[model samples]
Target chain A: MKLGDPRKAYRIAQGAKVRLNEDDAADMSLCPEGGKNSTQGLFDSLRDRIQTLQKVLYAENKRRVLVIIQAMDTGGKDGCVKHVFSRVDPQGVNVKAFKKPTEDELAHDFLWRVHPHVPGNGEIVIFNRSHYEDIIAVRVKKLLPESVWKKRYQHVLDFERMLAEEGTTIVKLFLHISKDEQKRRLEKRLENPAKHWKFHVDDLADRKRWHDFTGAYEDLIERTSTDYAPWFVIPADRKWYRNLCVAKLFADTLEDLELNFPERDFDPSSIRIDD
Target chain B: MKLGDPRKAYRIAQGAKVRLNEDDAADMSLCPEGGKNSTQGLFDSLRDRIQTLQKVLYAENKRRVLVIIQAMDTGGKDGCVKHVFSRVDPQGVNVKAFKKPTEDELAHDFLWRVHPHVPGNGEIVIFNRSHYEDIIAVRVKKLLPESVWKKRYQHVLDFERMLAEEGTTIVKLFLHISKDEQKRRLEKRLENPAKHWKFHVDDLADRKRWHDFTGAYEDLIERTSTDYAPWFVIPADRKWYRNLCVAKLFADTLEDLELNFPERDFDPSSIRIDD
Candidate 1:
């Protein structure tokens, strides 16, 4: 569970079984006890780098980045987003939270509801939950037949590959948290006076079928983790470690692109005022 | 000119001549000399009111507000927007700036480029420059014949009426600035090293056609300022006064709605958590 080489270590192996229960929930070596100060120092440096990279991406207006985050209940997706992307200008980033599909959305093809939310040139788009739900949710709940739902994995791969060919950098993250920790978090949501509004009876029903959902995620991570669009399974019981891992991945992805300040279109010396 | 009774004072007269040069550019009587302090006090108060009202609007999720601001070059449209809307939540408000229409946009009816940007339920959308530009820009530059452009005033009125009937409160403001003031601002944009990038060569050509453009705006303000959606001819010579006046209009408009918190769908006294 050491996050030594996140790109290689944490990325889900192509053909290996993703046993969600087997993974360590809290890796203390990655995040030492009482380590908020040291973790925040690394986070600040990484966050500042993302802010600068985002500006260059905006100015270049050539490449697009889409970050898709999927998580179990109370798995800290929001916290990871806030800490990692807080420094980037809101104008440059568009966050779309995919809720239950509307009646109109249901009428269209599944990707139809998701396609329009994709990032445009020089933009960064974060999908809080995304098209992957078509496979996992439907499969877990038997919303669609096995024949229909199984084909979506290939469709998802093709759609993402087309986007890559057209200049979109896709990064998908499946935040990994233990089931026992999820119960703790969900119980906290009900116990905290301020968090009563966040709880739903349906979450309890989903938690009851936790093993089924894990099996669905297991297949999802194995089948859809393409070379062009890899899925990173981050250790998420520790919020600080999750933030650092996500931020570092983003910084590395951006830096690897070799972004440079765009060449000026006009000569600065020629801007003479007649007045 | 005093800015008292802004809803009554600044709302353009239905049949009055909107002679740009003849209108008061410096409404200093409303703001005393060296009185930025007092003007800011009024602005701060109004801005805070807008912030509160906007949250109520979001909570109620019923009505929508669309603020259309049209101004000539260096006419303080951006300044007016920033000062008036500085305190509102970025999520609750949307700002859309219409630049030169692309070829795809020009292929459709003029309103085609605008209709998609309209406010949705419980939202406030500000159009920095809007479909009114179809009437003003093309009419001034003779991009289209009079036969084509003349028909659009009725089209504009009809569009605004439909929006009004559909629970959207539309406030269109014509930021009124004198030609002399525009020249001074444009000169500043060219002379200031930091602002050199904002200066464009086409702006000089547009400045030369100031009189022709005013005539176009004159007809636009007269024909389209209807009861359903009135145009406010804000005196833009003084930036702080313009901000205060616009903020007051928005605050008054929201206050008139008598917005209340939406009735809760669930009881807070429900069964306690087992945890």
Candidate 2:
């Protein structure tokens, strides 16, 4: 199969019912031949394509792209963003990691803090964690009531629709990892002193409530997967496959923009630079 | 008359045709009971009220206020922002000056740069020069064709409407200074070595196109002013009156929100700290 051909298998269809447990988190059916070792070359090529496309997007200076990565703790959001976008120009791409809301942020509507960070023209913005948290984390943690969280599904849809109409192409990715894989990763973090800071005790608390989170995620994906902003579920148990899929998804999405260098508005041959 | 009562006199009615030359740049009909020397106390009081209201705004943290100031070159945008908001807490009030567009900024839609600097919840953001520049400056300089800049009127209206519906209180001020006043200000800048840095030869180029800019401003204000985002033409020749008017405008705007410190989410009375 071609590198980008399997993307549809991972994308949750608009209006389709989603069951997180039904999807195989470790599935590598789309992996290229010689799986792990040979994947590096493919990943590098995709990264190079992303870099070239991003430069053209910058040169064209018109369209915007927003990439949102959502994953459970240890599901590799940071790792995925780092590996996939490492070769892209830092100036053209902005990565915003949404942490716990500040006192000021909690006071406004959830979308208030988010609106300012959307991409400008000729830019790509990556949300490490995003507005989806207002739905998923709020529901799972009972941060707000059912009514409040339930209403946000529509709010998110309306907001994303508006953004799409305003010339932003949005892609959301949910990294899927099995519960056993999460446990193994947690163990690996604990085993190494170098990774100790990465192992948060609160992550264990989140793991305990895994089923609640999964239910919330499933509901959100089903509700918010629209034509403008679709959700992709990447099987992330294998780090290499996850990276490859994400890189390919970005490359394919940017290529679809059909971006090219903007035509020079002036006749370059008639101009002379005086020293 | 009360400090804020005459604000309506300066506000351009929605859908009203504007003639910049007809408005008195030195008019002080809305100025306080006293002239410039005796106006210090009232201005101080207004500043104090602004500071107080800003604190409550910070504490409440639910609404946003955006102040957009537009003017010709040497029209005192910086001075007005500095004097009017001097007493307010810097943390709660953000002032963003939109200068010339970088190559990256020129690549996208006109509103792209402006959207990112808008006020957050409980924040009061001042745009030293704003999106109006896209209409006024672009037209005066013939940077883009009439077909391009003319469409921006509707774009701005729609964009501001969205912001207003999303809970931002919008106040746009056109610091209305006479052409003569601008010439005087420019001369004053050139006379003082300390102020020479503020004067630029390019400003003379803009001054030469004064009639073009005035005409453009009239058309934009006539077309784009809405009930949600009204434009107030401040008589800006008298620096003291201008500052007083702006201070009163802000204080009155924040007061209308009826902001109060949020009630404690957790009861302090129920818990005691262990020493």
Candidate 3:
């Protein structure tokens, strides 16, 4: 087996897991193992930026955040949600992961199911898997008509526009991972008994349609990346790099909003009381 | 001044703030403060309970939580949201404060302004001030006629019942502060420069009808407390005690739900491969 070249189309003739320990995985350049911590500075800067933005955001009560993550299987969505938002004030943030619709949910329009979950003013809402799934997974699984899936593009754009108009700032990310990397992750789940619970046989069916999902994503990004909600295509082949990219983007988005506390009229004499 | 007896009705004169830092303030005969601290422990346990519930609720695709906080002015609604839920995983909670409605919001049904912000399943949604104001503040301010405000009592019950039917566990709290204590807080706000921003002339206007507000609250508790969502009247003369009561109720509610992670099958060889 040979290490795939980043310059060209990397191909794996045999489907096998790539064993990456923390030490070995430190080589993220897609070259020979040159041991260096490349992600530390990116994460540190992100943490600081988030804190400052948070103070402003909580006080301002003017803006809202809606983070939409679209990814292939095992693209580190959970890990990103945990580590990136670890220090944020829980009171002002929310995470919503859209899964297969329940009976009551299926009775409504697709957007109806998700609308209630969007953050209000002075909030940050994360959609772990979002409306894109209707276009990506449901389309791949043929769960909906080609016409229904195709029409959702316009519906999604309109929905996002409404949110943006109403003070919700949207940041969408597509986590791009190579087929080989995904296979390796799927295998690791089988090896660790503790993690074996996370592996689902149904997930492989989704894995088989990888290219189709990517094509759907590429189209979704191209079409839905509007002035209000732009999509960031992150290279998620390296988990550390992926987390770093997301953290920076998340931090940058909040900072760009210029959140701050409203000005208060002060009366200094009010604090002193002669008993 | 002689301490008033806890056994009878004590006159709380107009504009006079009660000082309860003495023996009278320590009257916890019916339900002692020690028991309340244990309830505080129960509330602290909610953080862990919510974490476990998340895995199941996210997988099950149920996203809904509605937390209602109702109290007298300066009853620690903001503080409860900040302190009780401080340790919640930031990714799963949303907080909304409902102040006086804007012209647009007033044009719609009372619940209409609130429906959009309900928590998606696996997400905890909090209302710092809720739809109950349709009756309480509106009634006290003479903003609505008796016919309208009285009708709202039944409307609120139906509204909350609908939420519970949709799988939201409603936890309602009324921070019960004595009138004398309210005056002291108002004076403190007036005397402190930093605190001056919190006090407004309108607050004094609300205090003028304090008895009327109390009567409205008594009626509300009697009519609204049901099996689906029980109301807890927290003795809130002490801020720390108020937080403790709310925290205990919150923790006990989630723990009662008995949340647990779903078991998954493990296969070791399926996940491991070498380069």
Q: Score the docking of each candidate (DockQ).
A: 0.15, 0.02, 0.22
- Leading candidate by lDDT: 2
Model 1 lDDT, residue A6, Cα: 65
TM-score of only chain B in every candidate structure: 0.95, 0.97, 0.79
Quote the true-contact fraction of every model: 0.01, 0.00, 0.33
**Candidate structures ordered by TM-score, highest first:** 1, 3, 2
Candidate with better TM-score, 1 vs 2: 1
Candidate 3 scores an fnat of 0.33
Q: Per-residue lDDT tens digits of candidate 1, residues B201-251?
A: 788788878789888888899888878789988888878778878888899
Question: For model 2, how many clashes?
Answer: 1
Lowest-sum lDDT 10-residue window in model 2 chain B: B266-275
lDDT tens digits by residue: candidate 2, A147-254: 998999999999999999999999999999988888888777666544554555667688889889898889899999989999998899999989999998899999
List candidate 1 stretches off by more than 4 Å.
A1-56, A73-91, A173-204, A226-228, A232-264, A268-275, B1-56, B74-92, B175-199, B226-228, B233-261, B271-275
Model 3, residue B77: C-alpha shift (Å): 1.7
CA lDDT, every model vs. true structure: 0.79, 0.82, 0.68
lDDT per residue (tens digit) for residues A1-275 in model 1: 22344676678766666767645656535544456565667778888898788877876778999999998878887667766875565456666667788889988889998998799888888888999988888899898899998899999999999999999999999988888778778777656654554566777778777889888998899988877888988888878888888888898899888876555445556644332
Report lDDT (Cα) of residue A168, candidate 1: 95
Clashes in model 2: which pairs?
A61-B107
lDDT of 3: 0.68
lDDT of 3 at B231: 68
